[model samples]
Target chain A: MKTYKCYCIDLDGTVYRGKEPINETVQFVHHLQQQGKEPFFVTNNASQTPDQVLSKLSGFGIEAKRSHIMTSAMAAAKYIAYHYPGKDVSMIGERGLHDALLENGVNIVSSSKEVFVMGIDREITYEKLAQACLDIRQGATFISTNSDRAFPNERGLMPGNGAFTALIQNSTGIEPIFIGKPQGHMLEMIRLEHQYEKEDMVMIGDNYDTDIMAGINFGIDTIHVNTGVTSTEEALLKSVRPTGTFETLVECI
Target chain B: MKTYKCYCIDLDGTVYRGKEPINETVQFVHHLQQQGKEPFFVTNNASQTPDQVLSKLSGFGIEAKRSHIMTSAMAAAKYIAYHYPGKDVSMIGERGLHDALLENGVNIVSSSKEVFVMGIDREITYEKLAQACLDIRQGATFISTNSDRAFPNERGLMPGNGAFTALIQNSTGIEPIFIGKPQGHMLEMIRLEHQYEKEDMVMIGDNYDTDIMAGINFGIDTIHVNTGVTSTEEALLKSVRPTGTFETLVECI
Candidate 1:
């Protein structure tokens, strides 16, 4: 059992996509655990809840504890509460945004009242757009859960909250205060969660722009997997090349 | 009937979405033709062909001659052919990129043999990514339709090719030779299409980051539509404001 201080991994395109999980990935996680290593799954996709992700993973025979998962939405929630006076107004999104708002004790609103925080909302209408427009017109501050527009899935890329934010912005002159990765808060969340010094950590993922670059931006080591959008050869040739590169996390060990 | 030498219009939020159309938008075109303006439907979405867009618009009850459509994809393809030579490449997009490549007379390949082009493919995959990486490593060049991460829509923002491009770039260190708006070819397309001796021909669209700014970059007049991404008030408030700002094209008339 090789004991490592911390282990962070991306969810989609790495561990699983939709209802399916890479069984080899599950065994690798078990292998990591058996080796006395702690594993945590981090995801940029803001649509699903940690419970949902965990359940999906469990279906693939990988048991992910509630604490074993961290999401951009939850990190965003904590960031909002820490920065704002009390989350006076939030335009809001799906369960992730709601969960964050409630956890941070921030208030979510519909009309032109308080702060208008926007995120991924599967349920949307012109009614919500009208309300958000009114809120922005009235000078309520604007915020967004993340700037990711389309999230990748088995079916392909689907619209995320960045599109909704664009919708509200199109109706109002406001741009959101973004606190997701690349702009930095998720890294801080990772730090706060594990108390691991930045020197002790290495960010690993498939996407270079979001995952590897995000780690590099935060001054952390990155290991890019040629597993997602980029091919193995391309993954090997980044401007800010990863400290380690592999076809999969399984290969990293 | 009012007569004009040239006619140019907007796309995406302006016309068909999925399989639906906004009310009265198509009717406006009929009125435009009644006025005897040479019709040209200009678009920022570089995904579809003229026939495809025309067909989509026709399904939505707005039929246009294929020649009446001006797509950024076509513009990009022409730009590439005219500028760079002897580089036949592999592309991973819909009919739009395919048509663009063929029209430009560039030899298109989907395999590793002398592959020189990689166009935007929203319907991306690991196999495509691998092929692109292989060709790239073998010195194949890259081109993209557009860099937009997502298209703002009635439903929400759908992931555009830029997200896919980033995936490629992350993997390959090969930033594309971009040919869409606000970068290389769109301005040329605008100038060539409008044929206005007066540069005062205004480019109107809902996307501020691309459309308005691209017009500005091209030294053309632009009208910011609040229906897209940048609101009217915000568009006006910017230090570099649009020539005109409207809630919708209906208001401009």
Candidate 2:
């Protein structure tokens, strides 16, 4: 097995599955940490701030660095700051996205015809969506954190950020530039921030579509674990297979 | 112009646009009422009640009967009452849908696996959408009022019922049974209630996709008034053309 300098790990499915940590993944992450390597926690969950994510990880007995946590919100903020600098941005998101934008020095406005970013806003309203449509129609650059259609909760799989993004897209007939997994923006952000080559990075996750495709899209090696959304059998069936497919991260350890 | 006993007029584009009524449409409605024909005002707007719509019409100097007004909410209520009688139905809508379901004697429950109906809910919440997805995933029959992607408002083309429906559909991977224009449910309801044959009915509207398509789908005559969404030139390009296309309802008068 080959080792990478930067291991980009997905949070929800890879490290833990909604409050319960996968034992093998936890062990593998521990092994990496013991080797003086800090893996980046790359999550598409734009709802939570880095500190919140760190708290969740700490609950699972995994100590992660705040700077090593690259959320979709952070990536979107950085993407906007890098691409459209000095442009006023309008957003529809939660605390994570709002904080990330402020941290990245992106000017937040009530409404803008410059740029618009969206994430998982639990308190979503018709007025927010309406304003987004109006802005997009007025030639605002539309950007979304992720394209996850539905995500699992304690109750069931609920509508995620992508569904709301779909609403705005359907209403305005405009597609948004997604800055999450399967699009490679987050992975690219990690690479650029840490000054690591593509070969030095490897994405490890249990989801085939978001995690594996994200790595592949970013031209990095990907390892798919079968302890979550996609099984080994399903991952093998894809035309462009992952670099490695295992029953669990224990195999890598 | 071919005279019809039942003239099924669309509300938004045909009768009025936003707060203002089209003068020709007002005159046309007055003409029909003077001739002792109470034309049915068929609308995909599931937000307002029949009385509310009637009051708006009356404000434009056109007296319309309460029974002669058919909203998507009413049609959805009647559809549920007829097909799935006594079924506990769950909904995501406003006063119109709420009253319509209760008036039709359809049992309304907080959450149900029997039936789920959705309308244009401006006060849409993430929890409401989550509950709807959960109910639909639990094998509930999903139904939406209309499929109009965007509706005009004071601001601009805001996210309509169809956009929200698309959100639920995307999340649950379930197609909803649309009970609005372009599906013929409202027209079918009007036909069944008034005991008028399809031949005796004519759908008059400014939007070709919703109004004309509904009439054609219901196997009734359709008149296209170029005063709203679809222009007369664009209506002429469709493979299935309306029976008549005019600049305004004054041409028909």
Candidate 3:
């Protein structure tokens, strides 16, 4: 376990099913901690807050701190704060984004007749959309929390932040500054969190399009989990496949 | 206008900006009406029902009958019905999908875990996701409304049905039968709707990934509008460029 300085695990399939964590996950995580290896819980699901995720993991007895987790939503908010701070933002987002911005002390307004911060808001409205258009036409900057359009749920799939991003972009004729997964910022943030540079990092996740692709795009090592849509065969067949494949952490560990 | 038999106009930049219709869009639509050309409003936006779309369009004084409008949401439900008829479904969608499936006379249940049709639901919940996963594990067939991931909107961009499609795909290791733009079905539907064969019809819209590519994929002439994010320059530089490019409909007309 010491051989791996940093181990990142995906939710949904790799870690647990719903509220129930994987059988081997707890033992493996305990082993890693005892071996002094740092573990990171990372996901492309931008809908949930880190606290929410941490709480979910806590249900499985894996005590994770907010600092121990990195989400696309958080990463996106960090990107915006770094590049365009102190701007009046018109937000279409969930608690994750609203909390992130408030943490950074960014000003948010209801109207996009100002700059718009795009986030995953499950309760989207047409009036909000109208305000976003108004902002874009009024020459507001467009910022996206992340570019991931969808997230897998037990019900099938749900529209992630990118869905709202796409709609506003089409109507307003403005492109957004994407800040999350499948982008470079999250990689940097993860690297900083794990105290590993790009070369030493390995991204473990279930989705190929987000996790593996993020590693590939950022020139980092990737490990794909078969627990998601990507089978062992599918991972091997990718144009830019991951460096390793695992059915679950039980096999990899 | 009589030189063309069908008038396929894109929603965002081609028709209106936000709720306000674009200049000359009203006249061109009226022009088509007067010239006795059949008008079809094609949108890759799978969020709203066709009637909702019509209602929105009507807000700006553009009269659109629900029958004259086509969306990916409609295409997705119909495609699923064709393959998995009379099966209980878990729907991850908004009113658009609900209306479409209802219109198609497909039976839907709340706890359907066998066959599912996923679309963009702004108010998506974990229960819906869990049900989808449970059904898939139980050998359920998954169908997506579209694969666009995101669509252009006045709110800067929003999660389109494609985003919803991706979630289920990521979880179940299943690929959806996409029904919207850029996919083959919508164009086939367009041909059928306009009573025009592939050779005689032309697809005009703003999106390159959807409208232009769908047209090209189906062997029809394409007219690309820079209504959405794609500028006229970007639209032409595409590997699969459109047959013609216009900044706006008025320019082409």
Give the candidate number with the greatest DockQ.
2
Candidate 1 lDDT, B1-253, residue by residue in tens: 2233454556765554455675545666776667765456777566678887878887787778776676767876676677766666677777787887788897776764444444445455545655665566557656777777655545444445665565456545566777666662665665665566435355657667777786777776776666656677777878888777766665544
- Per-prediction tally of clashes: 8, 0, 38
lDDT string, candidate 3, B76-167, tens digits: 77776777778777777888888888888788887665677777776766456556756665677777766764444544455455644554
Tens-digit lDDT string for candidate 2 (A1-253):
8999999999888899898999999999999999999999999999899999999999999999999999999999999999999999999999999999999999999999999999999999888998999999999999999999999979989899999998888888999999999889998888888999999999998889999999999999999999889999999999999999988899998
| Model 2: colliding residue pairs | none
* Clash pairs for candidate 1: A89-A115, A90-A117, A91-A117, A112-A135, A170-B229, A234-B171, B89-B116, B89-B117
Displacement of residue B13 (Cα, Å) in model 2 is 2.0
lDDT of 3 by residue, A1-253 (tens): 3245766666766687665677677777877877787588877666688889988888888887678787767776676677777777778777877887777677778874546777777666655655675677678888787776455555445555665566666555578887765666777887765578666677777778777787778787888777756788988887877888777766666
Question: Candidate 3 at B87: error in angstroms?
Answer: 14
- How big is the positional error of residue A49 in model 2, measured in Å on the Cα after superposition? 1.2
Best by lDDT: 2
lDDT of 1 by residue, A1-253 (tens): 2234676777776787566776556777898788777687877656668888778787888887787677777777677677776646646577876876687787665554667767666565435655566666677777776666556554345555565565455445466776654555677687887698887776767777677777888887877776676665786776778777777767655
Residues B1-253, model 2: lDDT tens digits: 9999999999898888898989999988889888999899999999999999989998988889999999999999999999999899999999999999999999999999999999998898889999999999999999999998998888787889999998998888899999999999999888888899889999989888899999999999999999999999999999999999999998887
Ranking by lDDT: 2, 3, 1
